[model samples]
Target: MPRWFNTAGPCRADHHYMLPALRRLPEVLPLIGQESYFVLHAPRQVGKTTALRALAEELTASGRYAALHVSCEEGEAAGDDFAEAQRAILSRIRRSAEIYLPAELHPPPFPPSPDISLLGTALAAWARVCPRPLVLFFDEIDALRGQSLLNVLRQLRSGYSDRPTAFPASVVLCGLRDVRDYKVTTDSRGHLGTSSPFNIKVESLTLRNFTRDEVEELYQQHTHDTGQVFLPEAIDRAFYWTQGQPWLVNALARQMVEKLVPDRGQALTAAHVDAAKEILLRRQDTHLDSLAERLREPRVRRILEPLLAGLALGEVPADDLRFVQDLGLVRLAPAGGLEVANPLYREVIPRVLANTAFASLPPQSITWLRADGRLDTERLMEAFLAFWRQHGQPLLGTAPYHEIAPHLVLMAFLHRVANGGGTLEREYAIGTGRMDLCLRHGPDTLALELKVWRDGEKDPLEDGLVQLDGYLAGLGLDSGWLVIFDRRTGQPPIAERTRAVAATTSTGRRVTVVRA
Candidate 1:
């Protein structure tokens, strides 16, 4: 059977086009060799489970250790009940050991005890009787919560010194976060911030996304198997869109090969990859949906809100930034700042946030289209001005994020225009101090820059025009729009303030300045 790209679960060599899992996790072997307990963390679906499971099998096959990959996820349902959680975890470990380890290495049954804290004792007994030094990979360790989580970490820490002979040597705790970010509490009081119960963790290593070369190598597997080749430009486009995110890289390839263009005779081009990206964003597949659901989280909002609005992220807690990074919603930008992890996410974030507003919009006529079906720039601007006068304020409130309310409202209106087969692309980031929009309607391309005019600040028209000029230059256009949203106190109503005027940028580009 030919291997295919995998999106849903752990990648199996027999079924999926995959890279060497162990190569992605270089820190594991050295840590195991030194008999150290460590944490392996990364965003969901980035192959943490696959990597650890492969390591376990390889270690056991070497005949030097009894290694098993066990999950603590079942214990999540137990909540704060330490006894129930402990039982669920131990049962999972026993079942996993029976399947993955040799008969002689299978852990003996746990000693019957009422004390939930005896998990360490049970492990000690198993190690003492096992034929070899034991190595264990505990997956989903962060799924335990409240007292259950605290108890498990403390129990593991209690057995730290008894490794190799009395307890598992070189244990690994695997989850979406490092040990420092685990939420643990000793009593009914709120979270014990940053205080890890499992302080014995030697290091917290994160699994990184694939590099450009890795992305190409994985795609090449499909070509080698079935004779369907992805063109060089398509490969470059895929890397640019996904930033080597594993699931996204695979999903885009799957959508293009298996669904979009299944004919093996046709070469996949850059255009095919771009179309696949749009389909994935519109469909909001399980992975993207999971990411969208996290938008409601406070920490997620703290970073993403200002990011979308193109406002300065001032005074944000360091942990919040780190948390967002761990979730894979943002990354350290190559330009020395944080940005949405990839172009695909940059598009998804606003669309997901504007979904409600998109639905609430009244039906609009395509008055901006010329007789030849081309978009008329002036007519489009006039229509937007009229729409802003009528329903902009109300629609702004419909957005889930407040900082980007105006931006969302405008995007919702543009989405209505693009509904007729045009495309709207957005660009915003920290320190940008503005949001740039590019609308492509048939042969027409319009560039727009949006800036807010607050009470204490001067009018942003000069800066907006300058920025829009640069944006237009990049797109090889000679004209665009600079929209200044007057958000200052004591301003006239939106209807009264909304208007457009002709202006010229310092770079000699003609610009239509809209104030609303």
Candidate 2:
């Protein structure tokens, strides 16, 4: 049977076209040799479990250690009941060992005890009886929280010195966060603290997404199995869109092959990749949906709100920025600062946030279309001005992030305009102080830049025009719009303040300046 792309669970070599799992994790074996306890973390679906499981199998096969991968996810339901969580975790480990380890390496039965502190004693006994030095990978360790989470970490720390004989020689705690970020309550009274309970960790390692070459190599595995091929442009576009995110890379290929084009004789192209991307964005599959759920989190919002508004992140904690990066939602920009992790995420964030406002917008006709079905920029601008006059105030309240309220309202209106067989794209970055929009319909392309004029700041028209000029140059256009939203106190009503005027940029680009 031919192997295919995998989007769910751990990738099996016999059934999935996967990169060499162990090869991707180069630090695990060396750490184990040093008898080091460490943390392995990454965003969800980035293949942490698959790599750890494969490493455990390889280690066991080498006849030097009894290695096992056990999940603490089941214990999550036990909540703060450390005793119940301990039982569930031990049961999970027993089941996993029976399936993955040789009979002699299987841990002996746990002592029947209701005391929560006995977890360390049970593990110490297992290590003493096991035929070889034991190695344990605790997958999804962060799934435990509160007292349950604290108890587990404390138990492990209590057994730290007993390793190599009375306890596992090396233990790997695998989860979505580094140990320092783990939130635990100190007492039953519910006082919270951000301290590492598992302070014995030698290092914290993160699993990185595949590189462009790795993505190409993964796709070539499918070409080797079947006669189908992904064109070079398609591969490049896929990498650019996803930045080699593991699940996204696989999902795009799976979508193209299984849903878009199934015939082996049909070669995949960049257009197919684009269509697949649209489908995924519209469908909001489990992975993207999970990411969207993070938007509601306070820490996530602290960094993302200003990001979408194109403002400098003000006084955000360094750990907060690092947390978002670890979650794979953003990355350090090459120029400086942080940005949405990839083009795909950059597209998904605003669309997801604007979805509710888009639904609330009244039905709009395609009156801005010319006789030849091309989009008319002037007519579209007039229509948007009218829309802003009528509904922008009410719609702005629906946005979850107040810093980007105007931006979201405008995006909602544009979404409605582009609903009729047109495409809209957006670009913003930290400290840009503007949001750039591109609308493509048939042969017409409209470039729009949005800026907010606050009370303390001077007029934004000059800077907006200059920025829009550079943006237009990049798009090979000679003209565009610089929209200045007057948000200063004591300003006239939006209807009274809104109007458009013709202006020229310093770079000699003709710009229609819209003050609204």
Candidate 3:
């Protein structure tokens, strides 16, 4: 059995690999047939390159079309110099065609240094001699900037009429954003006219995450190959945290099968999954780091702030919206809302951005509330109240996370106390307008709800207590804390006040309100 999963795709050894079969959508296969110029897009590491490469291989192997996959990423460092970028692309294709296709298949008829643009001549030439119709895949096509990308797309458009005969029959522009979002500048006017570049795309396909069942199926592959069975909850946790993002799903499974699980002694479990998540996030591996990088962009921040606050924005431009979605920073909610893409992202992105704010605090001291050395809910909240009173405002400002900074800081503090020293479970939903922190210490469990309240509004205590009480009762828990940050209070010193359990709901749930 192999020691690692193929996460990046295909049979490659250097990149982490996952099965190529899982990434391709059935809808894309038909589009490949119509000789259409389509777009395949997703955030980095979502397998755009891998899927296209595998698809190209699949199509070419069928002997139906002459499929070729070429990467535009190689020329990306050339910057906005469209000519240099075009040269890089043509040279790359010439080399790939020679290696992958028959030598007699005929190279593109363009002159080595043509007076005309290399893109048009190259496509025209490649079509003339091919024994069969051609399928062209321009991977990382978005890497081309300004006129270069526009030129390539427009050249393809001009040649579209010759498809299945004089030009490549089918073309795919693969990148992070859709071709339509491209703001190509032509003739120096910066106008998106009817005949502008990048206007000739048909199908737009996004490679989606593995479904819940697909995740289990992939894990079953590992188990069958290596005899490493994942505990049921391990699979559940994997789906919950990653939502089947290809790289993360494979990475988690790889680490579990290879390192986290004991040597054929213990099954993989949720506890292991939880710990592995922290390890992967803390390592700031390339995948996680890239996701974190998008948060720093101003456009990203504009879209994300309201998302974090559970407020909806009106009429966001399609480009900025797609940009964040492509980055995997947000996901489409089932009810037509936007949400953080996944649980791990929701948990870790803030920490990655807000590391400085959290780092400034002294390490928290965890005291087991029970004499039997288990999690102490009462004591934890006691610690949190004091912590919030003294350090909440400073932490909020310094925290790198722009959204949900206050709530996450409090959770970080609680995690430092509970998970850091004792045992606790953290649960949350993206874009759900609420944060749920559950701490389990031995037989006792603490469920805390955090919210921000507007100053002019009436005391949320009545509603807050009812909510917390019901949440606790549902779990058969007697006590819980509902902490509401008074936004009207601004950054003032903490109120250091607590509302005792003076009231009971009709269902008899106990609720304690804390304003710290």
Q: Residue 497 of model 1: what lDDT?
A: 86
- Whole-model lDDT per candidate: 0.88, 0.87, 0.70
Write model 1 residue lDDT over 2-74, tens digit each, in one string.
Answer: 7899999899999999999998888789899999998888998899999989999999999999989999999
Mark the 10 consecutive residues where model 3 has the least summed lDDT: 186-195
Candidate 2 residue lDDT tens string, 1-516:
878899989999999999999777788889999999999989999999999999999999999999999999998998889888998999898899999999998888777655677678788889999989999999999888788988999889888998989989999999887876665653322322343677888988999889999999999998888889999999999999999999999999999999999998999999899888878888989999999998977778999998988898999877788788888999997887889999999989998998888888887776788888888888988898888888887888898888887888888888776766777788999988989999877678889999999879999987898889999999999999898888888987887778889999987889999888
Runs in model 1 deviating more than 4 A are 185-192
Which stretches of candidate 2 lie above 4 Å from their native place? 185-195
Better of 2 and 3 by lDDT: 2
Best by TM-score: 1
The order of the candidates by lDDT, greatest first, is 1, 2, 3
Greater-TM-score candidate between 1 and 3: 1
- Reference-based TM-score, model 3: 0.85
**Between which residue pairs do clashes occur in model 3?**
6-17, 6-18, 7-16, 7-17, 7-18, 8-16, 8-17, 109-125, 354-400, 375-441
Candidate 2: C-alpha RMSD to true structure equals 2.2
Counted clashes in each candidate structure: 0, 0, 10
> For residues 176-271, could you state the per-residue lDDT of candidate 3 as single tens digits?
777665545533223233334655677777888888888888777767666778888999999999988878888787777677775765689998
